[model samples]
Target: MSNIGVVSSCSCIHPLVHLLRPSIQKKGLHTAARLAAKDYYEVLVLGGGTGGITMSARMKRKVGAGNVAVVEPSETHYYQPIWTLVGAGAKKLATSARPTARVIPRGVEWIKSRVQELNPDKSCVYLENDKKISYKYLIIALGISLHYEKIKGLPEGFNHPHIGSNYSVHTVEKTWRALQDFKEGNAVFTFPNTPVKCAGAPQKIMYLTEAYLRKTGKRSTANIIFNTALGGIFGVQKYAEALLEIIKARDINVNYKRNLVEVRADIQEAVFENLDKPGVTEVYKYDMLHVTPPMGPPAVLLNSPVSDAAGWVDVDKETLQHKKYHNVFGIGDCTNLPTSKTAAAIAAQSGVLDKTISLVMKNKLPTKKYDGYTSCPLVTGYSRVILAEFDYNAQPLETFPIDQSKERLTMYYMKADMMPFLYWNGLLKGYWGGPGPIRKLLHLGLK
Candidate 1:
């Protein structure tokens, strides 16, 4: 029972009542303070990225506008997948961003605070300024983090000319500058050893660079090189074979099992360590360099009770629900889903998660399963893209009937133009849920 209930039920002598009055008032003040520090919502989403915003919008519809809240610090929400084109000078960076206020579903509370700690067991998250936000259900959409500093002479190396990374918003424009200023010699690109969002982005920029050099009549003088940590070009066998053919046709150098370890930006030198042979390293001088730095889970997830040993959110791969906590869920690049991290995957997962949450709310089992659908619009050139779509088993799950392995301008238009429109108008608004329905419709239910 509450203090008020005790006080109302009490029937004591005047002297006893007077003595107890002081203690009761003190207790009341303490309770008030605790209440003031805390806020509650029916649903609390923990990120402002693609997944978080999308889920929040969906949750607002299921619950009510006033019942949902989102905790995010960023003032600007970026359509990050477009950054690959932005870096290649195909799209402007400004077009890829929007004010967070504009994207967050109206009437849904935006906490505008960074998450300090997640106490799932307590059903609360601690934010900056000792603020406590409790929720009946929690959604973790905190995205992956890039570690450019992990590589020697880096984030700082980005300060130097002719070196840039598409992975970062700050340096994406610099990639365009470097490509435009390239005179001759080696134009090198790297794929890190760590799991990165859009695993194909590193090489996508390389292909654009090669195409750009050729268009500028500098291809004859420039030597395009791709130093990747992976043994193969791409994960899916069909797409890998297609990309290999493109590499050969472009006359690009492929140094497999090599990971960039350092950069000497002052002298334009890049160092790579052979992943197969631990300490064996190689150095190359470059006129232009694109570094895809190591990526990992966000810092707050490290040593967190809600995360796995790898620091990723521990969630069921099919339902996207917390493996241990029934009321907690995870989405996007933050979860250990054993699949490529891409916005397309999030779109598909969002639909399944929505169904799962709805069922859980009604005390029923989740029957809808996520097939780990993901896509990579491998931009092979300024006008061509190999649309690679697949599932968790690394099997091709193409949306179109035509060969997705072949580079096509139509796919490029979808990646560069149509997708952004869908993202802003459909996905973020909780309308788009990937190409699954369309795939089934096109295949006449036979696929």
Candidate 2:
């Protein structure tokens, strides 16, 4: 490995040149001699999102600070769970993001570069800047990538007045604006065929738009329609039952197995294809359209050997450890965990991975398990939410010892007021894992 410095002939001095000159002068132009003597960390985390941040902080506390390094490109950390609220006119998009430096664990080296290649066979990762990072253990927490381009005419027309998506912060506010400006005809919301981070987010915005329209006295002329690729309002039966009740009461038309294929923003038309029967297209003219575009793992991660066939980190469901490579672990939306990908799910997974990774590094089998706990604060109206919490078995795991499927004002307040603060101060800071302890305590250890 050569440590030679390359310089361009430009007159302007580069920032790195100024910084490195002091070290070069101290070492008498032989600084490259000390390159191989540096000690790398024991663990390397590839992202700084919810899972990566939580896992790194927990792991750093357990295995000392100098033993871990996080490779993340973004300087800002986003609380993506709040993007839904932002799109619903309940919160600002700015509130959903924070400086990554403030949230990452103390003493953890933050490499501000993307991982270009994963040489997992050699326990090293190549950076886009041509730097190689070696680690004794690796954790892949690179979150899902929103693929707006996957849908025809999507990226181009997404920011148009009547068309928007809640998946990205840049376009989420547009969704709320479109809803505010909607006066008549059909208000169409489409759920893509691909897996999304928050599966309920698509329809959540629809409910929010419905409430917004009603509030603005436009509900009479606007026909609220939910075109979902899935068969039901929710995967879990309990929550689905409640959602169905709301849909029927609101008189919202629900279309199943209908996926958005393209958006004709010029004419305010959205093209949909029936998933069950390909080539069967349905065009719906809309006054406003909220789209949840296709999402998947980051392209770099998908092309790496660490990814499974579905382009997600291939990990054991219970352990959160890689199937073949015991030293590698994964969490969050990027992992093939067979559960709904939500910040709540990532919080639960953080606890499981924090313990499992520590045991793996000690040459022991992981005893910790993740029961696939995930929660979605289903906001049906401005002051109502059904806090749907469940496990891998789809069994309801209510935290407050009450029926969480019913819409309640308290749940809505919790989602709006407390959850955001909890996410930033508690979860991202590696303080809150999940509602498991509270659930256990509330149920008197019966659950």
Candidate 3:
């Protein structure tokens, strides 16, 4: 019998609705024969987020749908890129959400539960309900963890009159409400000291708010402030130089080496600490505040065998395969990929990972590599964007003939309109393979 052939549920009739009931088994030992016999697959994916969805869909096509399974708990999936527009009231919050059932690839097995524990030694995973499933190959794409409580007074600060954050659907709409009601005083936006999914997201809203205020005639009355822990505006110097010019031209205050430590929503004040001078702290009064909270790899990865000291999956950065486990691969924010986390990075990683896994399945040495291609669409205003596409070395790998660091309407339309379609149709369907092909056609540069 082929190990990678069709798999069937023993008692469950509905493939999507029926789930493995809670049970405890570990290291492929001390498990009931019935449970162990019924729960096995050729390939197992550990997330339903961007990287997981794309890779699972691609894997299903390669190994046959019945041989693959994905473990994800959520029913609703959010197109997070559009949240910046949703928070600006330019796009409705409803546009960003979709039923997870609809987008999960046509035939892959969907286990609707959180992964409680990852066991690579036994090639099995423990679900939150305690049920266990074993697999020959594993893909880890569980993404990041958002820590709002780490900042003092956050759960309290959230939804306060002038406070807002675009990180969650619940609070995103509140940002537009706060922006619309503003009359005067300081409008503060903050970027945290830790690594976040989209490093540019913290300031994308700042620029949009500045534009909104100018359009609504409140720009003069309100002062725009961007407080960031980073020493500079952006990671890539070419883009950083362009962004500094933008903040200066718009008169938006840029405070480098400063971080938001607390949000005093009761008194409508925001507290900050100077990262350079450890003890120096300051509090600023605000009429409006947009916060980007600190983020990390999933909470489950803490101290796990698969994780690095920083709690990220320990993977070969170029191949995306786990450093110690040849059968395991990782993508997106959860992996120590040494690239800024973004959907664009996930898109590129998914393509590279999918191909490598297919080669490994065929009993071959995986030779594919991911070059750390990630893009950041810096939306400067309601109608303009600076699309920054680059590689591992901080070099501009422009997709178009024009300079990408400069703001343009065409790029804005791509971010505002084109990307969502590509994400929904091309990426989820396993047809989109990042922008490498497009870059080649436009620049005549091939490797």
Candidate 4:
């Protein structure tokens, strides 16, 4: 457990509360100092994203209020899944965000700061503000780091009116703006060589743009291209088959094993290197360019002993517990879990971590397991979606009885309408699972 004196008997406020509210700095100075001397938490979460919020709520219910603490720096939290829709003009960017303070669990402490160091041996994390916080157990859900600089022209390319990306809440609306202005030429979308938070998002906007083009009578004038570094259209075989069919039927170009390496913004040109053919390079002109930047784990965990060489937290794929530290666990894009990173995957992971961490806190072996359940609602158009759900094996462990590989309006409505409600009201509020129960119920109790 944590150092016993960290829990105050008078106001019961944590040192982190003082970090935010300055009024407490004077009134609770002594109290804050006392807490600073110990600075311990029963359960400390390292992010305020979907997974961390879920953990805070779940832990509060299990261990009671004020026992959990979350270390995060952001004032606004984005429901990032909706960003694709935002770029598509189906959803507004404003609707994707909420204040972080308003959403964290009722009695949980919020430390608004970035982490600088992790000391697993002492169960402590060092913050950029020069404060040390200790925990009995730790959960990492810091998510993927977007390396926009790795790409040659990047944000500098924003000077070109047609260039935008859905990864940033600020820039995603620009994609819709660019599409709305397009008279036509080349509309290029690229998938990076690195693992991204939502693997399908790079192309989701492409389909939306294509649909917009068709609706606006510019489909015949614009050449839509999907240049992916991967050898295939998608990771899952079944979904890949369906997507390829859609591509051929739509006459969209697929340049497999092609990676975007540079953006010549002045000329409205993008450079692509052939992954399979190393020595060859091609430059293509674009009227509109959507780029997906290279992604990796956050720099805080880069050289830490808790992380793998690739900078992801090293955890058991099944249990999500740190390989070297039983009290340390991981969830979401930060973990080297060998699955597509998405909010939907985090939803499944939250369920497993809630059960496993409870057992670990009680000095019991965790019997709960995560099956690498993940879902990607692949939006093919303004009103069609191919709902891809699968497991660790990449097999089609679909939720609905109907062929989910096929594009349908119902799936689009689920993605566009139902998912945002579930995220805000259900998942972040500490529900035990994702769509598992509903999937099972729909399947007549079948696994």
Candidate 5:
């Protein structure tokens, strides 16, 4: 079928087609058609990451095969939480990633192309090659984009020695190598000012690095420093208190409101800006630096009208529905939902989003509301983890009946040995829907 016909068939009217020259639209349409395809899906999901794949599977179970389609570019799907363990030299980087083709649920169409544009008014999405796919209902799960180049002189540090970021699967091993090579001087870890996928990840690796250095008898020479852009170590008070105690005992320097703006690879210097005072800057010399780059929604979502001022999907927090469009829903790190962006949170959101979207598709009012549950497994040392689980109110909503603020080996075992299995075999398979049931069972009507 012709590209224009394919796009038009999906009920999408490209704004660029009308705004730009006819020749440009014609050319772009051909590209978009080849990229998107003429197939009309009942539920079209953009980005086949954790939330997208999970939702697609659930929708397929409800509607049947060929009812759902997922648009994603990469063939490899990464287990991002394991990057911390990889940086700590606890797990190999290779072990944390798998081919996307292997994990995408059966009986669903996978469009191996990047989405270039979104047309909510017309209920269609434009693909990179200029094809358009139409959907009766749409789910946005494109996830966040890591902007490493935003920091000046970062390329030099990332491409050179002594500086590494655990955010990517490729450079995660470099973090362990840098930690292993460090003998003395300041080992600096930075948390950017922007919202990150896992808020606790930047510091989790720091604690692990500190513990690794101590185990190797280099603790006396190494000065571990955590430079964060936030006002406190953690947003939650109970967990922050526990972390402060660990910092004092480990002799790690904690510098709050410090944002990394530049890196000087030749001299091993990192420049920082005080967020409170915009123009003021500070430079620290370091032997090793681990950077967490600023992140934001993908460019396609940012440029679309469906996006908020912050460049995230404008959605109602409770319903996960687009602010202006009733047919559109969002999940994962891409939405401007008031919650900590993590896979665990996404797991909880998937259940809520699935129920809400399904009801909306059937012309029924959505009764399900997301509680903004998020979990961060703060790996303090090689064998310990503080499982911080909370809701929007910052109250501890832990699954186990025990206190979760304290560092425990059981939590570490769960993070290391159990959660990965749950993530792969259960969560992705459309079986695991957070710990809602387990929480109720554990409480046993105590309230």
Candidate 6:
């Protein structure tokens, strides 16, 4: 039977919701009996995020829609890249979200369940309640996890005003609130010590805040400071040089090797531990604080055979195929691909992964290689953006013929207006890959 039919008929699909009502628990008992029946699919995509949905759509064309199933528990799918603009009050938070149900490809089975364990050797996954779902081919795209709790007082400190994080769905809008309520004093932004989904996001908000404050005639009163754990502003040298010039011009203070450790929200103080010095910390009084919490691989990947020592899915950087398990593949923020984790990276990786899987199914080798192409639309202001596109070597692999390191209004429109439309229609539908073809066309007869 179709997974949808079972979901509609049985409350077992939502065990937590079923547990809420004693009356439903009685019905859930009988539903558990039916749930015990094992299910299998030709292709099982483990997440419903950008990579998972895109791959599932591609897989549906290769295999039938009914033969593919996705295991995801969320009710809403977010276009997370937009949160920068959303936090800056350039876009509404509502515009960045859509119903997950609406985006799941038609005729594909949506198994609304959280993955508990991945038994790759057994060619199956263990879902919640010990339900087993086997598959011929598996795609692991379970993205990274945000650890606000790792800090001294956060995930709860957010409850207090004068603090917000653009990294989270819950706390994103609070950033706008904090910015608006700012009268004067230190408006501090942070970047975590670990690998983040969008490395450019932390500083992106800082730039927007500077612009916002200037526009509101509060620039002189506000001391805009950025504390980051990274030694450099950006990985790419070309973009970093450009950004440094902007920082000098705008008079934004950037302190390197400083990591946020605590948020005393009540006292309006933020504490940072210098990575260079052990057990040494400094506290700054802030009128408003924007935190970029430490991030890492999801808990499910911990101790799993499919993961590396650091807990990210172990996959080949070129092919995105599992080094050990040929039948398994990975993409996006979940994999240790040595690239900046962004939706643009996923779009490029999806194209390469699609080819890799196709060739593997034919008992052949994958010829295509991913260049680690990722783009970050560094929103410098409400109207300006520096389109930073680069590859594995941190070299600029720009798409347009013009200089991309400089901030431009056209790029801002592309980031704010065009990217979301393409994400929903092109990337999700498996039709739009990266800008490889367009780049080739535009750069014709030129180096």
| TM, every model | 0.91, 0.90, 0.91, 0.91, 0.91, 0.92
lDDT of each: 0.83, 0.77, 0.78, 0.79, 0.79, 0.82
Q: In model 6, which regions exceed 4 Å deviation?
A: 1-38, 445-447
Cα error of candidate 6 at position 316, Å = 0.6
Candidate 4 local Cα displacement, residue 310, angstroms = 0.5
In model 4, what is the error at residue 19, expressed in angstroms? 39
lDDT tens string, model 3, 1-447? 001000100000111101222212111211111222348889888877887878887887788877878777776777888888877888998887777777677667777777788888898888865788999999998888777878899877775788888887668888989999999989999999898877888899999999998998988998999999999899898999999999999999989999999989988999999999998998999999998887777877888788999999999878898999889989887888888888888877777888788788788877888998888888899999888877888787676777889999977888877777777766656666677766676677763
Runs of candidate 2 with Cα error greater than 4 angstroms are 1-39
Per-residue lDDT for 259 in model 2? Answer: 91
Give the clash count for each candidate: 0, 0, 0, 0, 7, 0
Candidate 6: 10-residue stretch with minimal lDDT: 5-14
- Which pairs of residues collide in candidate 5? 31-129, 31-130, 32-129, 32-130, 32-131, 33-130, 33-131
Candidate 4 residues lying further than 4 Å off, grouped into runs, are 1-38
Candidate with more favorable, higher lDDT: 1 or 4:
1
Give the per-residue lDDT of model 2 (tens digit) for 98-215: 7677776767667777778988898888877577888888888888877778778878896579877777766878988887788899999999888887788888888988888888
Q: Name the candidate, 1 or 2, with the larger TM-score value.
A: 1
Cα lDDT for residue 245, candidate 2:
92
Model 1 alpha-carbon drift over 4 Å, by segment: 1-38
Against the true structure, candidate 1 has what lDDT?
A: 0.83
lDDT of 2 at 73: 73
True-structure lDDT of candidate 3: 0.78
RMSD values for the candidates in order, in angstroms, are 14.6, 10.3, 9.5, 8.6, 10.4, 9.3
Best by lDDT: 1
Per-residue alpha-carbon lDDT of candidate 4 for residues 80-120, written as tens digits (9 for 90 to 100): 88878888889998887887877777667787787889999
Model 2, backbone clash pairs (residues 3+ apart or across chains), number = 0
